[model samples]
Target: MKKRTDQFYLVREDMLSEAMLKTIKAKMLLENGKFNKINEVVKEVDLSRSAFYKYKDGIFPFHTMVKEKIITLSIHLEDRSGALSKLLSLIAQTGANVLTINQTIPLQGRATITLSIETAAMTADVTVLLGKIEELDAVVKVELIGSGA
Candidate 1:
C-alpha cells in the first residue's frame, strides 16, 4: 500500500502554466460576482471547462490564504535611526492592524523584530506588503513565521 500526503508551494505566477493561470482567472471571475456559472467563467477567461476543473482545486491566489487571519513575521533590520518607525509606517499603510510587536536590543547594528498582525482589514495582499518591506533599505530580511486565527 502507498500513502499520500498533501504538499504546497509558493510559486511565482510566471512559473505557472497557461492553463493554471487561466484556471486562477476563471476562479476569480466566479468569486467576485462577475460570473455565476463555471461555464461563464471558463469562457470569460478563455479556458476550457476541463482545464479549469483540473486546476481549480489546486491553485489559489496568495491573498486568499491569509485573509481574515492573524500572522506573525520575524524581521531582521539594521539599527539605523528611525528604521523601526519606518517599518511600522509601511505596515500601517497596508491596513494590517498590529496586534503586538517585540524587538530585541540592537547588537552590532542589527535588531530582530517580531510582529503579530491582524489581516482582516488589510487593503492589499500580504505578499505585496512583504515585497514592499523587502525593498526597504534598512531591512535585512523578512520571514512569515506563522499564521492562525
Candidate 2:
C-alpha cells in the first residue's frame, strides 16, 4: 500500500466539479451571514443539503488555505533600476500578495531583499514561485528564509 500523507492539494477553480463549486458558494453564503440557515444557503447556491454537508468539511475557499501561511524569502538582486519593479510585477502576475518588503543598501552592485508573501491566492506553490523568481535577470539568488503555518 502507498503511504498516506496529510496534505491539501490546491486546484484551479476551473478544475472543480460543479457540485463542489456549489458547495463552496453555499458555505460562503453562510459564513458571510448572507443566509442564516443552511437550507437558504443551499437553495441560493443550487446545492443539495446532503452534498453541502459532504463537502463542507473537505473543501475550503482559496484564501482559507493561506490564512496562516506566510513565506519569507531572501533574495540577492543586482543594483539597477527596474529590477525591483520587474520582480514585483512577476509576483503580482502569479497571484501572490506581498505582505512586507525590506531592502538593504546596495554595495558591490548587489543588494539583499527580504520579502514576505501570503501564498493563499498564489497561482503556484512556493518551490515553483521561487524558481520563477530566480529566473529573473536581476535576481542573483533566491532562498526561502522561513515559512509559518
Candidate 3:
C-alpha cells in the first residue's frame, strides 16, 4: 500500500497568485481581531468565501511559521577553562537560544553539562548543530536526551 504523506513548500509571497494572497490577507484580518465576520474580511480582501474556506486552515502568516521546538542535550566536556564558553558561542552562532544550563562538577577531568535550547530560530538542523559541537576539541560526547515540537 502506498503511504499518504503531507508535504509543505516555502514559496515567496510575491510569487503567489492574487487570489491566494487575498485569501491570506482575509485570514490575517480575522486573526488580528480587525473584522468580526468572515464575509466582511473576504469582501475587504476581494476574495470569494469559497476560496477563503478552501485555504483558511491551510495558510498562516510567515512570522508564525515555525512552531515552538525545544531540544535538551547532554554533553560531556573536558574540564578545561573555556570549554563551556566555546560551546555556548557555537550555539549562539546557530541562533539556537539557550533556555537553561546545568553543569555538574568535574569528576576525573570530565563534566556533564545539560542544556535546554529553543530551536525556533536555529539556522541549521538540530542534528547538524549537535554534530558541529561534537567535533570541538574539548567535547568528549554529545547525546540528545529529548526534544519537542
**Which parts of model 2 are misplaced by more than 4 Å?**
1-5, 73-79, 85-114, 117-149
Give TM-scores for every candidate, taking all chains together and pairing residue i with residue i: 0.91, 0.56, 0.55
Per-residue lDDT value at 125 in model 1: 88
All candidates in order of lDDT, best leading: 1, 2, 3
TM-score of 3: 0.55
- Per-residue lDDT of 1-149 in model 3, one digit per residue for the tens? 96745676668888987888998888778888999999999999889999988877776654355434888899999999999999999999999999999999999999999999999888877767888999999999998877777
lDDT of each: 0.90, 0.87, 0.86
Show where candidate 1 strays beyond 4 Å.
1-4
Name the lDDT value of residue 78 in candidate 3: 99
Q: Relative to the unseen true structure, what is the C-alpha lDDT of residue 65 in candidate 1, on a scale of 0 to 100?
A: 74
Q: For model 2, how big is the CA root-mean-square deviation?
A: 7.3
On TM-score, the candidate that comes out on top is 1
Residue lDDT tens for model 2, 1-149: 97856687879999999999999888878888999999888889888889999888888875565455688889999999999999999889989889999999999999999999988787776767888999999999998767786
Output the number of the lDDT-best candidate. Answer: 1
